[model samples]
Target: MIALVTAALAPGIALLSYFYLRNEYESRTFTQVLRAFIIGALLVFPIMVLQYALEAESIFEAEWLHAFVGVAGLEEFFKWFLLYFAIYRFVLFQSRYDGIIYGVALSLGFASAENVMYLMALGIDSAIGRAFLPVSSHALFGVVMGYYMGCAKKSDPNNFKLWISLSLVVPIILHGVYDLILLTIHENVMFIIVPFMFFLWWFALSRTKKANEKMA
Candidate 1:
């Protein structure tokens, strides 16, 4: 039982820890971050219901369409909504880096819950694979979303629209590609997930630096 719990939680916690350390502002309280994470985990229930409904309706028959529009689109949009509505207007969101903090908190929350479900159903081997892929993939998506959200917050009123759009759109694109590659899962295409993950890590780290610079 302990091992299962650890398998369920470790990936998300590790990713969240890394991002928490990256947060220079440290303006948000632990309670606030916990609230964001709880909100995100709570949201998974509804999202899963929707995804199951879609699968029941055979909406996932077209793999690319399902991976991109259905799965990635639905997941990212809701995650975006959770961040935008739950924390975007909060007073503590003063620094540009706050978005990344909140974004990772929420995204990791979702990932943790999702990871538990997969681990329970598919066993530890699946959990091991997910730790390296799905959990971190969601974290990368969070970084992309948060970076734009930070920009949106700091941008001129005229540019707010563009940054806000990117906050939602970029994650959807990255998530879509990530899911598509995994869904395809061919011997030939298997090599692609590696380079893609590397790029995601590099991109997320660069975004963190940029957000830190904005804070400075």
Candidate 2:
């Protein structure tokens, strides 16, 4: 069990550390980051309850609604809320890069808990797939979300709305499309999944660089 949890959590922590180290302008204290991460982890329960309620009512029967509205949209919104309410408004959030840092911290927190549950249910063999796909995907989604929020943070008054809107919308789209593809998985679809993941990584790294530039 210990090993199982370690396998489940390692990737998320690694990703969290990577993002944390990128904060060149202002270093956030460990306590601040830990608060965000713990809050994010706690959010998974409520999100799961809401998702279960939606599923119980047959809300997830429709593929598009399930993937887009139910899963991706709902999950991302809660994470965004955590950042907006809990972390975004904090005084430590002085630069655009700080958004990405906190955003990834929250996301990895969510991913870590989710991964543990999945690995426990599915057994250790599933760890490799979960680590690469769901865990890393959440990190990527967080990057996209944070990048826009970072833009919103640094935006002139007039541009705040646009960047804030993108902060939510872009992640929902990427996550929705990602879940939508997996929902329809078949033998030949591996081709699409690989390229899509590659694209997500590329987009995430590019945005990461841009966000880091703000610190410079």
Candidate 3:
């Protein structure tokens, strides 16, 4: 059980540390980041309940709808909402890169909790694949979300809406597409999933670089 818990949480903790350390300008307090992470981790239960309700009601009959709207939509929407309401207004959220840090904190929190619950139910043999896939993907998605949100924080009123919209919409799309690919593709799943993950890494890193550059 200890091993399972460790395996489940290690990826998210490692990823969160990596992104948190990337802040070059201002550093956020550990409390603030941990708060965001806890908030994110707590989101899992509500989302699961919602997803289960939708499934029970047969609200989404199609796989695409399930992936895009049912899964990604609910997950990203809640994260975006919390990030906006919970951490966005913090005075400590001073740097553009801070958005990335908090975003990662929130995302990995959710991912870590979800991973643990999943492994607990399914067993630890799948832990390695999950660390590389779902856990890492959540971190990347957070980067994209946080990058635009950081922009939104600093943008003029005219562009604030645009950045904020991208902050939510873009992550939903990326997450939706990711789920869609997994749901639709059965044979040789890695062939497509691997490239998509590569794209996510490239896009996320570029966003990270740009955010850092803006800070500099």
Give TM-scores for every candidate, taking all chains together and pairing residue i with residue i.
0.95, 0.95, 0.97
Instruction: List, residue by residue over 39-89, the lDDT tens digit for candidate 2.
Output: 878888899999999999997798988999999999999999888888877
lDDT (10s digit) by residue, model 3, range 99-144: 8888899999999999999999999999999999999999999999
Whole-model lDDT per candidate = 0.87, 0.87, 0.92
Candidate 3: regions farther than 4 A off:
none
For candidate 1, lDDT tens digit of each residue in 1-216? 779879889988888888988777657788888888888788889999999999999977998998888889999999999899889877466677888888898999999999888888888878878988889999889988988998888767699989999999999989999989988887776589989999999999999999888532
Q: Could you arrange the candidates by TM-score from highest to lowest?
A: 3, 2, 1
Regions of candidate 1 where Cα sits further than 4 Å from its true position: none
The total of clashing pairs for model 2 equals 0
TM-score leader = 3
